[model samples]
Target: MKSFRRHTESHRTDSIGWLRAAVLGANDGIVSTASLLVGVAAAGASPGTLLVTGVAGLVAGAMSMAAGEYVSVYSQADTEAADLSRERSELEADPVAETRELTAIYVGRGLEPALAQQVATQLMAHDALGAHARDELGISEAFTAKPVQAALASAASFAVGAALPLGIAWLAPAASLMVWVGLTSLLFLALLGAVAARVGGASMAVGAWRVTFWGALAMVITAGVGRLFGAVV
Candidate 1:
């Protein structure tokens, strides 16, 4: 019995749900807020105006992330529920056919036909719905959509990420506010990317470069537009 006991181990898949939400929220918050501030500063916006704009961006971005994540994740959850419901009906209406489907799935996965049939029958006997949901539908608890969790995570991470540039903008001199916010935001994004990559078991440098590149591009374009508009005005 002791030898048969299962040992626990953690995998990156376990954190997939929250990790994705956090990374996206944080990246968007930083990039958007920083770009906004830099663009405004380039347009010769006063310090007071910059701070106000940053604060407003932070609030709006956080709320947007929360609502967006909730609706998107809810849609996924709804789809999954519908699928499970349909699967349940099939299970109840024609269990024999369902069993054959399961057996065929196992056969496709390299199991012998006789062994696949036996395995499928035993699994269905144990928990028909669960087995079908996992193997047939590719739905499991780890991948199950949780709208509330996703929304909260996105909102919280977005606020946190937005605060970095906002704080820097508040403290930095007005003469160089754009440079300060832009440089520091890139640093923040690099760190965010590296940390996210590390957690997700990817190349830190690659992730960092990927995020920083996009952020830089956004800031540059926004600043250019602001400069152009300011000169025109």
Candidate 2:
């Protein structure tokens, strides 16, 4: 007799939910905080003022990210639930039609009609709602909306990202605060993009360039506005 091995595969789809929230939160945190500090510094704000503003921006950004993620994800969860409920009712009302629908879906996916019908029949017999939810509605355990999880990940990542520029602002020489914050924040954004790309199985260079470009643009515009205001005032 030969020994058999049961192999399991892991995919990035499982991490999509939290990964999206975390990346968005951290990117926003770094860009917004760095821009805020650079803008203020360009306006000749005192070190004390820069520190206060950076801290305030960090706190506000984190809270906003949390609230935004929670509300949005909760709405998604609600929609998914409503869809599942409707699907369940439809399945109960006309199980035969639902089976046909599932069969059509599988057939569309390249299975022969008769084979699709057989597969759909077996799956529905085993778990009708599960079949409909997964096949028809495109909802699955791995892709389910998780509001609390998204909220926490967004909030925590935002705070951590914001802290990088904030700490630099607090420590850098007052005259060159903007320079330090801008450069360091760009580096932070690039690193974040690379890390996120690695996790999501994307090209690291592309991800880093994408994030760094936007971050740099934001800081430049903000700094220009601050300089204009400083000169006028």
Q: After superposition, how far is residue 166 of candidate 2 from its true place, in Å?
A: 0.5
| Steric collisions counted per model | 0, 0
**Residue range 1-233, candidate 2, lDDT tens digits:** 99888755778988999999999999999999999999888888889999999999999999999999999999999999999999989988999999999999999999999999999999999999999999989999889999999999999999999999999998898878888999999999999999999999999999999999999999999999999998899
Q: Rate the local accuracy (lDDT) of all candidates.
A: 0.95, 0.95
Task: Show where candidate 2 strays beyond 4 Å.
Answer: 1-8
What TM-score would candidate 2 get against the native?
0.96
Indicate the TM-score of model 1: 0.97
RMSD (Cα, Å) of model 2: 1.8
Candidate 2 lDDT at 232 equals 90
Model 1, residue pairs in steric clash: none
